[model samples]
Target chain A: MLFRNILFFMGESWKNLFRNGWMSLASIGVVAVTLFILSVFVLINMNVHHLTEVIEQDVEIALYIDEEATSDEREQLVENLRNHPEIKKADFVSKEEGLERLRDQLGEENGLLEGYENPEDNPLRDAYEISMHDPEAVSSVAREIETYPAVGGVEFGEDVVENLFDFTGVLQVTVMGLMVALALTATFLISHTIRLTVMLRKREITIMKYVGATNWFIRWPFLFEGFNLGLLGTVIPLVGIYFGYESVLQWIDANLKFFPSLIPLETAMGQVIILVVPLGMALGIIGSLISMGRYLKV
Target chain B: MIEAVNVTKKYNDGNQALKKVSFLIDRGEFVFLVGQSGAGKSTLFKMIIKELVPTSGTLKVFGRDVSRLRGKEVSVLRRNIGIVFQDFRLLEEKTVYDNIAFAMRASGASPREMRKRIPQVLEQVGLKKKVYSRVNELSGGELQRAGIARAISNRPAMIVADEPTGNLDPQTSMDIIKLLRNINVKGTTVLVATHDQQIVDELKKRVIYLEEGRIVGDQEKGAYVRAL
Candidate 1:
């Protein structure tokens, strides 16, 4: 019995969708545009979040080791840093390696620093670059590392980290608010579109009501119609997003190298596809339900 | 089968469609609710089908107070009382067979039952040959017959047809009236609201006459009596 009704409603829904061709197209058009806009926002938000995470991961406190300190003391300091739960990794950089890094950075400018290249005259310090698993803990870790007697100095980009945190926080809130507003607007548009379709069939609906059809009996086909429309609307966006995302990613990689790279398509595409289809269907269903409430009142 | 006690319906615009009307329609009786246009005949039909609620009275059908019925209960009440509109109200795209079958399908009758009952109802309404024809292709009388078939397909206890033959020619109207009479003979209570005085006088069934939303005359085997 249930199976029969499912087929009946499905068939009726399909018929209604096609019978009113222009209206159905109009409905699908609205849904597609809404979903496309929503997908664009999601992609932008996801990339922005990814960029923030990358910047946060780069925050590190550099603890300058005392030149006279013994290797055992250095090892003990490393052990102490690692014992702190917030410290992700503490790697020691010797003065020689630091000097080599400076030379690489200077490139042709190394000639200017030739006099300071001698091992006896080397001014670079042996330091531990302390990485924190939680970026918010960077200042606390820097303060704790400063108490070490063997530490000559502690340095990190405190102002840069704070600004980045504040900016990302605001961006996240704004992105979330935009997504909610877009969802509501999309639902409302879809409902209005479906309501037009319902209005066109008002006579059939009134006749159905007169002939003893239950509210669900009258409602299910329309609901299915909305679901199908939503599913149809998702098609263009999914095609655009799935195939388009890679090209956009490649373009960014080629032209926008200075900006942090977006999350790989392989990593991000799955989440997007999962979200878009269901969201599209939900919008369609909600819109149809809202329209159905008016007609079913007899 | 149906009872209305002092049922008064005041519209949102403050127009009173029915004023303190009281009547009881017994089971298996054919009734003619004769009235002029705007005499509240349509309103009374709407009330009987539970489409319109009485403003301040108890209206019951099948022993349930319809004015207080919930959404689900309304459909149940409607299932037992078939309603036919003057417009024929058939889905023009659907065939005559599908039109009648549609009603059976609404109440969740099995396909086998639908297949069996649909032809029977169409035959009962004398539309056996027009079963596969689309409703738009049918003439005025044929469409009305299909509408009546759809109404009686569920074997309802009562059939409330509001101006069923209002759009038909006099000859065709007589045919449709006879079809309804046959269904009444088969034991369904039939209530027809019409303004055709010739047919009303000819049939001479019990008549309740209305004028300006008030019942002015009630007679057994009544003739059509126009108000002065």
Candidate 2:
């Protein structure tokens, strides 16, 4: 009986597909477009999260020491900074190295420094370039470094780091909101499509009822129709998402060489494909079920 | 067996289709409900299938009270009672064989049983050659036979046909009535709602005559005696 019902359902769904050809086409088209847009939004949101995390991992705070401290005291402070639990890596940049870095940034504009007395004569503090286990732990680490007698002050740009973190938070919330809105709109479109399909088959359903068909028997075909629509709709968008992710990855790899590790294109593609098929099926099944529940009662 | 005690159905628009009407039909009996267009014949038929509830009354079919049945119980009741509509209501897109098989499948019949019984039912209805024919391609008589095949496919204990030959000619009407009589002879209670005086007079079966939603006459082996 179960096997017969399944075969009957498949056959009926196929018949309905042909009988309501234009409407079925419209339904499938709507499902495909809505799912495509939703998949794109998910891909964008995930990529943004990946990019933010990569940038966060690269941000480090630099702590400079007081010029009055003796060489040995400065060395001790450097050792202490390296041993801190939060510190991933800590290296001291001598005053000469700092001046050299400034010179390189100034380029040929170093002619302005020629009028000054020996650049080495100017008092400059040695700085520790510190990388921490977590970007969020930077402030506490800075405080600890400031208590050292040899340290002049922590010199990391607190405002810049805080603003970057805040920007990423806002971006995450905005993406989440957009994702929800897209999903709702997709569901609504799919639902409307399925409802139209039901309307087209109303007469056929009434006849089925009078012919002694059970409610589930009448419902199975339409459920299968919805499942097929959802599955078909996911195909194009999943392919588009794959190519889109690859293009973005290629652009980042070529242009943003300074950015730390990029997410591999294959991994992103695999995840998108995994997520899209089920999402498509869910949308299809849910839309069809809702429409059928309201209209197939007879 | 079918029995109704003071069954009443009042539409929401203040139209009382059947008002405290009562009747009884025995197993293997061929009965006719004769009435005018607005005289509640269809309402009584609908009530028998539990499609419409009586405002206040009791209806028992095969010894089970239909008024208290719900969900699957109602469906099960329907499965045991075959119903034919005035419009035939055949799935126009399906072949005759498929339509009959659909009924069997809905009642949860096994495939082996369906394969065995469908051909037998088709031959019984004299449509063995037209089994693969689409309903839209069949004549009025052939379509009615297909409808009969579907109604009787599940071997229901009772068959309720509302205007089974409403759209056929006089000759076709007799053939359809003869088919119903044959089904009746097979021990399935048959209740037909019609105004064909010729058929009623010719069959001379039990007739329940109605006027203004009230039974005016119910006689054993009676003829059509009431006029509009």
Candidate 3:
């Protein structure tokens, strides 16, 4: 197309955008509303995947030593556990050192722990605070250690760990499935909406057909409308998400401080744009193509 | 230049619009296809522009088979032949300039060329002063002139007008035919399909008469034979 033709088509498409004012507005509204929900889920899915990853890497297993185990036996247990293939690090926490950590967690309540200050009064057991190369192997490794004679109990938060794994697994799949469904529904809706606008121009298309206009010439203006509508529709929601997600992240930071750090604003925005803009454009293209196929047989 | 050798078109309902129709139109010739409402005049004109292909026989325009033309090839064929319609099939809400520019742009005329040529054609059609007037604002004659201006604006090798003056008064109708005659005199072939006997008898041009889906008469400077 000539530069002038492109400019003409752009002007024509802009006019078409307002030709059926309510129809165009409705099309844009559909895209914006659909993408708004889509981006929220996409964000949540990303953050959950990120947070679970952080937790998975940092979770460790703690093995408690029996009171009857002598210092030498405790040393042997630690040595044997360190040699375990799945164990990354098996540092021993003595009863006194364990008391120190308890006091740190207790904060102002540490004065109540003064009763256990004497050596004989210390009732805490020696434990091996073990980290693993693979967090998935934590349960199996802890269970095996519990069977050893020197190990009294293994506490890597069995119930909490199982539930966290279950929750992350289900949430990841469900959110991902929901995102795909939303995108498909949005595309289907936008295609049909644009078809109505194209239908309104059936006679105009017939006139163009007889005017010796090439199929491409007849299609260019509509395609331009589709491209721009797609662009504007998807961008509107992304803009909403851009401002909204920032404060939402702030709230999460203030309250869910224990959760792993999330995707930053710029990265998340870039990701959505990259994934979303083309989909939006495709929706418009498919829509106009289908409409034209019916009315523009020439 | 069009050649139709036994061209036939049958509607799906088995109505035979044209039966073994054959005619040859030379370059720079002005021919009027005159017939009753169902005499297949419009269908012949459509075949010339490749809007409707023959059901069986070969119809050639500019020495190429029309039915063989595909996609953009058909558009290229139409660009060489401008068409004017009775109802003034135009972008009605747009200015007279846009209506003419449409045909020019369809053939991919540049902005510079359109700027330079639109006025020239409009001037030739006596519409120079009304270039920006909306099409719906024009009188019947003026609308037909705008239609003629658009037809000639592309500078096609030929012009095809189907009932070009159907809605105009007798005087306006003659004016439109003369305008088309003026275009034809400039050495472009012109084919007009109409039942208007007044202009046909008055103009004394070549007339091809059709009856019952076949050409019943063909004469140089032929007179329209009125139905008894």
Candidate 4:
């Protein structure tokens, strides 16, 4: 009996959907546009994170060892730094290599150095270029490395690391705020749509109530209708997200070839597909339920 | 069997729709409640069906106190007490068959039972041939028959019809009264609220007359009496 009623309910709900074709389309359109905007926000947020990570990878701490340190001591210091959980990579840079790099940077400005003694006479200590696992981890790792007797000084762009961290924090907050606002807007729009639909069926509902149909029996089909509308709305936006993410990645790859390790468009697309469908359906169901709550009482 | 003990109903606007109305209707008996507009015939019908709670009196229908019924209990009570509206309250979007089937479904009738019983009810109401006809396509008389078919689809213990024949032709009205009488003879209590003097005089069944939300007369085989 329950199964049969469910079937009949679903059939009736579908008929209602077709009967109110333009209204259903309008509701679905609202859902689709809202989900599309939400998906775009998600994609942009992910890509921004990817870009920031790339920039973070390039900022590293340079640790200069004491001049009196032996090769073995220096090797031990390098090994210790490598084993540190915060360090991504560590390599030794000899004094000669550092002098050569400085000279390369000062090319064609040798006139300023002509009257001065040979810059190589005061050989700088061997230094270890250590990339931390994350830009934020640099300060703490540098402090730990400073405790080593073989280490003289540590240098890294603290301001850049702080700026990157702050940027990510602000992005997260903004995304959260935008998501909450969009969710409220979606709820308002979808609920009003359902309210209008319920108003149109007010007589039918009143008659059903007169005929002794339970609250659940009358409510289930309408709720399912809303869920179906939401699901339908999700289809177009999901497909659009997939194609849009791919096309944007393609454009970036073709035009901005300098940036490497861009986030895979497929991964971002998958995330959006996973998130938007449930969100849309939840909004739809909640909206329908709220409207039904008022109108079904009769 | 239905019984009201001094039932009273007052609307929010301070209009008293039913005022200390009391009556008893025996099982398997047909009764006519006659009154002019705003005389509380509909209010009495609403009370019997538990659609409106009395302001200060008890109403018992089919051994249940309708005055106190709520939630699933009200639905359960309604399942055994069919109601027909004067407007024929059929779902216009549904076919005659679906309209009757919906009544059975709401009462939790099994599909097998529905399959066997829906056709039988439609046949009883002479709507067997028009079972699949949409309500909008049916004539005023046919629609009334469809409404009757839906009312009796569940074989309810009692049927409360408010102005069932008001919109039908004289012959169609007689046909509807005869149909209700037939169902009453078959053991379902039937209550018809109408002011059709011709039908009331012709049928000569028990009559309860209401005037200004109060029963002014009760008679056996009565004529329609106009009371202000």
> How displaced is residue A8 in candidate 3, in Å?
2.1
**Candidate ordering by TM-score (highest first):** 3, 2, 4, 1
Which stretches of candidate 3 lie above 4 Å from their native place? A63-88, A92-128, A133-136, A147-153, A157-165, A168-184, B226-228
Candidate chain B TM-scores, in order: 0.97, 0.97, 0.97, 0.95
- Which TM-score value belongs to model 1? 0.77
Model 1 residue runs over 4 Å out of place are: A19-167, A173-177, A248-262, A294-296, B226-228
How many pairs collide in each candidate, listed in order? Answer: 0, 1, 0, 1
Q: Over the stretch B184-224, how does candidate 2's per-residue lDDT look in tens digits?
A: 99899999999788889999899999888998889888888
Ranked by TM-score, the better of candidates 1 and 2 is: 2
Supply candidate 2's per-residue lDDT for A127: 82
TM-score of chain B of 1: 0.97
Query: Which 10 consecutive positions of candidate 3 chain A have the poorest summed lDDT?
Result: A185-194
- Pairs of residues clashing in candidate 4: B8-B55
Best by DockQ: 3
Candidate 3 CAPRI-style tier: medium
Query: What tier of docking accuracy does candidate 2 attain?
Result: acceptable
Worst 10 residues of 2 chain A by lDDT: A253-262
Write the residue-wise lDDT of candidate 4 on B1-228 in tens digits.
788898889999999999898888898888899888999988887777677888898888887788778788877787787788889998898899888877777667778898999899988988899988899999988998898888888778889999998988899899888988888889998889996887898898899988899889989877776333
Estimate, for each residue in A156-190, the C-alpha lDDT of model 2 and write its tens digit.
54565466568757866876676567656556655
